[model samples]
Target: MNKEALKKKLFTEIYDTHWLKLYLHLLKMLDDEDDAKDVVQEVFASLWNNFDAISIHTSFTSYLYSSVRNRAINYLAHKKVVISYEKAEELRDVNFSNAPDIFLIEKELAFQINSEIDNLPPKMAAIFKKSRLENKSYREIAEELDIAENTVKKQISRALHLLRQKFIHIKYYLFFL
Candidate 1:
């Protein structure tokens, strides 16, 4: 088989063998069926995108399990951030008049961010927008643009790097960085 076909076949075998087990493991750890499913899907998607560069120091099963565990941890971390942001939003709403300056700062920060994203190279900006604003997976963005997933990932990474450099002075918005 050609390299691409062989790669796809190997990926299919790995998915067929480990997907269910990974999902079940996550389900046990997370105790939420939907969240577990999402995490498993994300792990597999990441594996597919970075397949060529992946190095297995141990068994494939071990690698997959580790990926799933890390993704679940990140998922939980993001949930915590969302909850915290919601509470902060509520407090800000209660003291809207007193926090007008804070609100203005947030607006300016957002504007700066958007301007920076727009300043990225055209292809990088497009991929970054599809990945972040449209919430598309790297695989989805690659397929849609008829480019490699690695290209999509690299563009997004570069875009973020540039944005971070532009906003390095804005320490309070570290979440974006």
Candidate 2:
């Protein structure tokens, strides 16, 4: 089969084999059927779009599972932020003061955190996400990635250091203005 044919075949095989399991796993994580279905659909859609460039460090199943898990985490985190902002807006019903400040703080914090994560070296960023975003212990991350626990620790430490510098600069910049 050619590259195009292989990509199409692989996507079909994987989607058929994994879709239900992925959906169930996401349902367990998200506790809502619609959200679970949406996340699973997104995982497959991403796989389809990036099929040519996709790389799997481990088994394809592991990669698929991790992708769904990460997507669910991001969705829940965003949902939490939305809830917080909505609550803040409700508070604005009583007082309009500082509404923009609240929004600015929310937007700034999320942007800084996401940008810093994206800016990290790939290995460091992956380790950091496994640790912080997935809430995996150092040992767990190490085992999952087949690396030393100390390496995991060091990568996470480096990530934290870089993020701290970025945040400190942001704080000073905002404070001055």
Candidate 3:
């Protein structure tokens, strides 16, 4: 079938019949109603654009579900980075009574932390921010991210290990004092 014809058929058959199911599936994955709806819309738009290339044997519902899952994950990851940057900025403004050198060292440490966070894989970055800066419980972070609590804990642990490696010099710098 032609592109337009397949799009119409997919839209009419898959969308009309399964949109609610798709949205609910996304909602479960995302844990946010509005985000689920938004992801579903994006999935459909992508389907329309790529209709000609899609194999008929590929399960459309599965593809839509996976698309929504990935988009929601990316959205959550972006949000975590924004929150981390904002928190870092807030920390920078705090008054420190230490000597000028000490203040400068603290500022440098904060900068290094932020840079390491920016370099993390998306889910690891989000997990680190939510658990460390936000002080969110592992259960809460897992629920929000639709991941297992063990996964949240592991990601945070891994992030901390990477940050420690990245800033190992900080410890030596302190020891020289």
The model with the greatest lDDT is: 1
Per-residue alpha-carbon lDDT of candidate 1 for residues 1-177, written as tens digits (9 for 90 to 100): 899999899999988999899989999999999999999999989999999999999988888899999999999999999999999998768677665577677798889899999999999999999999999999999999999999999999999999988888898554433
lDDT of 3 by residue, 15-77 (tens): 788789888887887788888888788878877777767775567666666777788788789
Ranking the candidates on TM-score from highest down gives 1, 2, 3
Candidate 2: how many backbone clashes? 0
Could you tally the backbone clashes for each prediction?
A: 0, 0, 0
Report the lDDT tens digits of candidate 2 across residue range 7-51.
898789999999999999888889999999999999999999988
Give the TM-score comparing model 3 with the true structure, all chains together: 0.46
The TM-scores of all predictions, comma-separated, are 0.53, 0.52, 0.46
- Candidate lDDT scores, in order, read 0.91, 0.89, 0.82
Query: Which residues of candidate 1, in runs, are more than 4 Å off?
Result: 97-177
Best by TM-score: 1
Two-way TM-score contest, 2 vs 3, winner = 2
